[model samples]
Target: MADHHHLHRSTKNRNGFYVKMKFFRTKNGKPEKPFFVKHFKWILWFSLSFYFFAKFLNNHESSTNNNSLKTSIINHSHRALSESILQKPKTSHGLLNDLKVYIYELPSKYNTDWLSNDRCRNHLFASEVAIHRALTKSDFRTFDPMEADFFFVPVYVSCNFSTVNGFPAIGHARALLSSAVELISSELPFWKRSNGSDHVFVASHDYGACFHAMEDRAIADGIPEFMKNSIILQTFGVKYNHPCQNVEHIVIPPYISPEKVQSTLLKSPIDGQRDIFVFFRGKMEVHPKNVSGRFYSKRVRTEILRKYGNDRRFYLKRHRFAGYQSEIVRSVFCLCPLGWAPWSPRLVESVALGCVPVIIADGIRLPFESAVPWSEISLTVREADVAKLGGVLDYVAATNLSAIQRNLWDRKLRQSLLFHDDVESGDATWQVLVALSRKLGRSHRRLRVSSE
Candidate 1:
């Protein structure tokens, strides 16, 4: 067969060139793993679908940029706490703008002899340790109305101390602390009165003695606009001479209490049994017919009880029972009559209970800065000299009451009737009540040019 048909056509052209070189070495030649594992499983499924579509578009742009930075910090903290509670600012110098009045806490409604059995029928007669030494440690029930700039508050409630009911009762005036619970709970939007400002009352002592007997019942019962029409009233101490403007003491806290001489109502003047203690009681009117200092204090207490009638240590008290500490430690002296005149509280509780006060009264001013060393203590007298009170009780029976001269006469009677020793009239009445509360927080055309 012509060489067997050329060796069978050269073994069928070398077996069809080895099946086309194994299909071009598995489609192109080198990368061959079982046909290059079927084209490497379509290039690993298009590279895992483009790496999960770029990780789902970068996690949806990182959750929309973390919810736009938490809604821009909650709308800038709700527009800064709502413009700090709507522009808060009522007086105290539009809310403390450099105000400096320095500590004061008054809280009145007096009466506290376990709620009264008639202890000095209160009129704001102090004693909570003289209102904690006049708020020096700052507690006035609990002060801090934003570190006060003005706070006198005593429109008049009167304290007769009673609870099983009988005379002008109601009490409690709070504020022990915690910033007075944001000042009496209004949450201090600068004590709003439309941020205009006004607050201060302080008039008592019979409405600063006749503000026309309570100014037409405080302007037809509302007490002349209670507060905030840019408030301003200001009548405190020296008053009652009536007939127009001058009143202004207001620096309170000396209603007697140097720990009322360690009170427990101080009884032992020899365990009392009336060794003569008499601070008046009930229906008192020693003789008030037309009160010309009433029949000379019962004709000078009946000539000192007819010159000490059988000397049971003679006595005569009243001013509602001389605010007791055992009637001023079984008093050796203290008559202080005036039956209510230019001054009272018997010239400050018989010179803060070391006793020896006599006074009598006629135009008595005697608070201090002048004739006070009364030969060491006190004994005024004159109301047309009640027949020279038996020669001033024979010169107080020839003087002899010493306990180291009654502790140097109770330290010169607490430096002349303690007004906390005139700290410059309590810093000029707290700078005239904080300049009339910044002149009623101006701007009604500056309060009509400050009330003209």
Candidate 2:
């Protein structure tokens, strides 16, 4: 009876209230429990309760500390750390769900035959060729269309280069692609089986499936009716209400010759001293024309030339340079102003060579934003803010330039922006697979099993 008497505990809980409890006898009492059996349930209950309470408090405190640490990193002065909020990949999330892709073996006329033009597989717009080449040899590819999660349509539309100008003449793109779709729809059961929703097409050109270089014409034409329901992997994207990108699509980076980027890296290491302050060597016409009621670069190029053309810190040129990739490696900031289209190859080239890209295109949606920290790695100057670019860039150089450079030079980040002949882990091709895996809800195979 004395051992079972209630007592007041001086120890307070988190609420600062003293706890009252009964004392247990260890020695003075008769062995009614045999010191164990009689009160075994209470002892076990108290022990478990204490353990659970301790674990709960520890978990709550640990979670709070972790969240505070993440907040501390984001609020740090190095602006690049602000990427902690963006959905950037902490890991590659490699080959999610064992995703499988099926490549439609259309006649050589639709794909491989175009490779006869050596430039077809190596040009700036050659992603249409590279992805297909890589997929045929990738683990994701399956010859059995029945087990495929998504069907890949390989059509080389950007290969018909004009002899006179050496630029891709894509006038026949719509008809050529239309023919391929017709062949697959009639003979193959896959396209019709899924209503083309599980099929994927690559439009590595100026305006995506609109298939025109001119934006006005591209928008007027719009994504083809046949391709509207299918998935399109394209380079053309804008964060606006544009008809050209109204269909299901993923923004992909334009093709940049990996060999050329590698060659430039060999000549000048990414960590090498950048001699040029600001570099641009593409077409910056002194007098741009309003072709089809659109001025070249929308006068953005001319504005850049007018404002910083003579400034020693800004190196602007109007002519073509073959060794431009080498120059990019030796530059601090590379100008990626809008050309005929909002997207440009310079975005990839500059990043690969460790040059900070000064993007002047407004509303441009970059590729693999989830994998590549675009906001942290590059500077985006709106088209309206072109005149003040000098001040803006100077401020960045003074404030967070090193942080941005550190993010840009990350080898895996840069590799995500270029397509290699083969799929390397975390490369652009692999990133595409990761993206497709997230869209597995669209897989007809999964739907069939669930419904059945």
Candidate 3:
């Protein structure tokens, strides 16, 4: 029986070498050092590592009905993930190509001084502030101007709110921007070196670098000569040729706080218990006045008000509501009609808060098309078809609304639209860097390589 088969002792080694069980008693059955004492350092290392790894995965892995708890976990995860990418070995996606942006430190009047008014950072036009703040703290920010691929000129021109109408008075935009250019040009050689070709500026207002809300006036004003060669990151864009978008530009999403989105998400359900059918809260004029023959919102909003003002299906409100975001989270379809500009903040808020956006802007160019699947996630209704918005939404609700919402809820898409305090991987600022990385041929560093 022994010759046929037998189980060996636990100490048996097939390689004819001693494999010590350090935890076990040694030769004379006398205990060596205690296992816990010997392996304490290794245990501590693993414990600490597992702690961080588990924290990073907590929100993605665990499912719970407590949305507030889920939100808390996710906020923690976002912070941890943001910090990890800066210190850890770099990965491929998000902040791709290790893109570097050198933020120009102008006088306080150009940037921080405007932040004395809290609205400057959170308003619809606050991307001018958000991107600047994100870049200043990011690892991609190079301290040496010589090493920078692109220079960021931070000029906050939207914070000067009109005391009368509460709208930003951008009358000072051009002068301030030109002054910033002049200061940077005289102080640094980078501006003249590339003729501002490698420089980046934010024109997060209605008509981009033209710095006007009125399209006709904006066209007449045109992009400033000093900024004509620079790369503009602006909320304004269009499909057709327009004077405002004449320069090299990248379309950017209007600023909406990520914290605001998260707070709303905490109180909201997973799939969102959307009760309101069609949601619109902003101005829907009953009688749109024509200014220079261009009616308000091209009279599209006026048409909506005339048709659906009393329609119970469409939850329309004309007055201001600070908690409009809460209403957005509970709605099925959010109306993102045009205002002075084709693009609106609701487009980002609706997508971020889980409402299916029904885009009513014509000839509008959306931001981050490379990262965001706009056509798939959002439904576009022509400006002429404002009268049929109800039936069109009804058809979608009956047929493929679920599919659209699923696409809209993709975290990557949402991430690519909002700027956090620090640049998070796959967030809005990161997408900007990704877009800039593709334009490296315009950079001075790359030009030096070509000449060499």
Pick the TM-score winner: 3
lDDT of 2 by residue, 183-261 (tens): 7887767788888999999998889999999988988888889999888999998999899899888989999988888
Candidate 2 to native Cα RMSD, angstroms: 17.4
Q: How well is each residue in 28-118 modelled by candidate 3, as lDDT tens digits?
A: 8764777788899999999999878877576455444223322433454565466776776444434356566777767787889999999
Model 2: lDDT equals: 0.83
Please name the candidate that would achieve the greatest lDDT relative to the true structure.
3
Backbone clash total, candidate 3: 0
> How well does each candidate superpose onto the true structure, as a TM-score?
0.25, 0.79, 0.79
Task: By TM-score, rank the candidates, best first.
Answer: 3, 2, 1
Taken over the whole model, the C-alpha lDDT of each candidate is 0.40, 0.83, 0.85
- In model 3, where do residues sit more than 4 Å from their true spots? 1-95
Question: On a 0 to 1 TM-score scale, where does candidate 1 land against the true structure?
Answer: 0.25
Candidate 3 colliding pairs: none
